[model samples]
Target: MNGVITPADTLGTRLTGLRGFYRAGYRSVLAYRADLLFGVIGFVIQTVLAVAVWRVLYDGHDEVAGVASSTAVAYAVLAGCIQSVVMPWQFSSLPQRVFRGQIGVDMMRPRSLISQNLAQAAGTMVGRLPIGVAGLAVGLALGGVQAPRSLLDLFASAVSILLGIANIMTINLLVSMIAFWTLETGGVMILYRFASAFLSGALIPLWFMPEWLQPIIGRLPFQAQIYAPLSIWFGTRHGGELIGTLALQLGWVLALFVLLQLVWRRAVHRVVVLGG
Candidate 1:
């Protein structure tokens, strides 16, 4: 009985392994203190600049597309901070490791590769949380970020944010898994980041986009990543509309996770080592 492991033990072991990956990922970000400092400074500057740009756009108008100028400014500030924390720029290190023949080591680990990667990504996001918080503080000081319209709005936004984070991590994981076939994804990763920024509404809100394009973007998973939660926070989405948006986010997260599994199965077989 002592030598035999129980199901609960097995589960605990697996969770412990995942936590190791999370801590490693988190510490890696904090290892370079200078980078952390500069990163926060850069993000603060970016948030402020984005806020200023939105203000300029709304210079002579009280509202555009039924969204008040103040709302737009707050959206920009929060969007920038959210984008900073989401950190879509790097996407994942999978493609690079694959190209370098290091993925074989990852595959050899006892845990599932996808779970490990997601845990690491979550760690990295947590590590960068301070930067987002600092940017929000700046926004608050500048009067660019306002309180939620109501407590319900706050609660709904919080749930949507979690879903949005899952949607983002899953989508990015799918992108990273592309390395199994391509072996190198520098150009593709860059392109994906650019497209995500626009489509996710981090660069420009859907309200400001062309009339015909708004609904189309709304249907995409990218919108669920940043726009949906922020819109909920802004009180633009509520009632049945809020429920629908959250449902869509959950749907995309589930669908993307399924797609990730399919891709991962093929990806594992395609791993390339440095030598025979």
Candidate 2:
């Protein structure tokens, strides 16, 4: 049973397993209604602060760092909305899963362990989507997200948003596998998030940064994950540039998954996270 499993066999088994795992993750998140409520509350508070920041900057300059007033507000609203689309509920959750021995159990599966976890993590995203959608609608209505003038633009926006999520989920699975070697999950999570927020245009739009910072920021993959897509919707980057942005996102998704396979193999061979 061990050697050279066929691709067809591998796929069929994985699909069945993932379906169950995904549902379980959904149920698990829903069971903790308090957490979802608190998350919503926090998001609301953050949205208000973000809107205030953008408004002040826009008022001062007519354009905040060369970005239109409407675009800046949309950025803030999208940042809030995008928060729920990402995977890895909390950075520490991965280490906690390992410390409790879930990693070992996950490793025992016939399918790619990363896919299994990702599918489950996706469920959590789906669970949060409804409330997050409603919240984003409310925030945008109050804060003013620029509406797409055309159906094509709207469709593109939706595609970019989902692909952005896919790109994020891929990166976090790679990050989570770090629980295999070091107990410093907090540090890894913090660094990953900080880099993403700042460079990815969530914390501040790249337009707001000095010219010197813009080049440095553009080179990083972080920008491609979220801001690049959002930029397309904002019409800051259009057509081929937008297509290229999505290509980069897909590229990252593939590259990160391959890199994660290597890490998972090594961690499975060496690390011993008891019970998790």
Candidate 2 weakest lDDT stretch, 10 residues: 84-93
Candidate whose lDDT is highest: 1
Which stretch of 10 consecutive residues in model 1 shows the poorest summed lDDT? 267-276
lDDT of 2 by residue, 213-262 (tens): 89888766677666776777777656787677677777776777788778
Residue 93 lDDT in model 1? 71
Per-model TM-score, in order, reads 0.94, 0.86
Query: How big is the positional error of residue 224 in model 2, measured in Å on the Cα after superposition?
Result: 1.9
lDDT of 1 by residue, 184-221 (tens): 68788888888998999988889889999999999999
Q: Kindly state the number of residue pairs that clash in model 1.
A: 0
Scored against the true structure, residue 199 in model 2 reaches a CA lDDT of 81
Instruction: List where candidate 2 sits over 4 angstroms from the true fold.
Output: 1-13, 87-93, 272-276
- Cα-based lDDT at residue 140, candidate 2: 68
Q: After aligning candidate 2 to the native by TM-score, how far in Å is the CA of 127 from where it should be?
A: 1.8
The best candidate by TM-score is 1
- List the RMSD of every prediction in angstroms: 2.0, 3.8
lDDT of each: 0.87, 0.72
Model 1, residue 156: displacement in angstroms? 0.7
